[model samples]
Target: MAKYLMLKHYRGAPAAVNNVMMDQWTQDEISAHIQYMNDFADRLKEAGEFVDAQALAPEGTWVQYGGEGRPPVTDGPFAETKDLIAGWMVIDVDSYDRALELAGELSAAPGAGGRPIHEWLELRPFMGEAHTITE
Candidate 1:
């Protein structure tokens, strides 16, 4: 099986059908959303396809090493940044199509009013370390 990364973006993607900000959701709606996400991950684990999943906090800094003896330089989690990855799920599935199917399911997560969000998710395949005939 191969591992694939399914990325959920907060911005820089097609807008969701229920495009309301999460902060605007009611307490009940937020609870339902969290429940749905937990259920999805549980189902994936039951199917033996789940590798890992995580959500990132909005507040984070971008840092890079300045030099051999210098301190690392840090920059803002700038408001002007175009792309922000909200979360990701790593799945070890049988084929690329299977990865797509799982990503589709995740994209169907509940949004405002307990309806499917129809969000867009980015799917990327992992590179293998094995030597191939082409090499």
Candidate 2:
């Protein structure tokens, strides 16, 4: 099976149908959203196609390596409008179509009113050790 990376972007995509931010949601809504995500992962695990998944904290810092013995350069976590990756899931699937199907399901996760979010997801295939076509 080929591995694919499913990327959920918080920024850089058109706004979701249910665009209200999490901070605006009720506590129960937030809990439900979290539960839905957990269940999704569990379902994938049962199917044996799940490789790995992770959610990133809203806050992040950019750091660049400095020359030897010097301190690294740090940048802001960035504003809400800046590019922010919400999370990712790596799946080992039988075909490209299967990968896309799973991504569509993920994009349908519940939103504020418990309705489908219809969010956008970026899908990419992993290139394991391989030589260029020219080779």
lDDT of 1 by residue, 45-95 (tens): 999999999999878899999999999999997999989989999999999
Minimal lDDT window, size 10, model 2: 76-85
**Which clashing pairs does model 1 show?**
none
Point out where model 1 deviates above 4 Å: 131-135
Per-candidate Cα lDDT values, in order, are: 0.91, 0.89
In terms of lDDT, model 2 sits at 0.89
- Tens digit of lDDT per residue, candidate 2, span 1-135? 899999999788788888888888888888888888899899999999999998898788889998899999899866855678888999999999999999999988888888878888899999976657854
Model 1, C-alpha of 52: deviation from truth (Å)? 0.4
- Look at candidate 1 and tell me the lDDT of residue 48: 99
The C-alpha local distance difference test score for the whole of candidate 1 amounts to 0.91
- Mark the regions of model 2 whose C-alpha exceeds 4 Å error after superposition: 131-135
Q: How close is every model to the real structure, measured as TM-score?
A: 0.91, 0.85
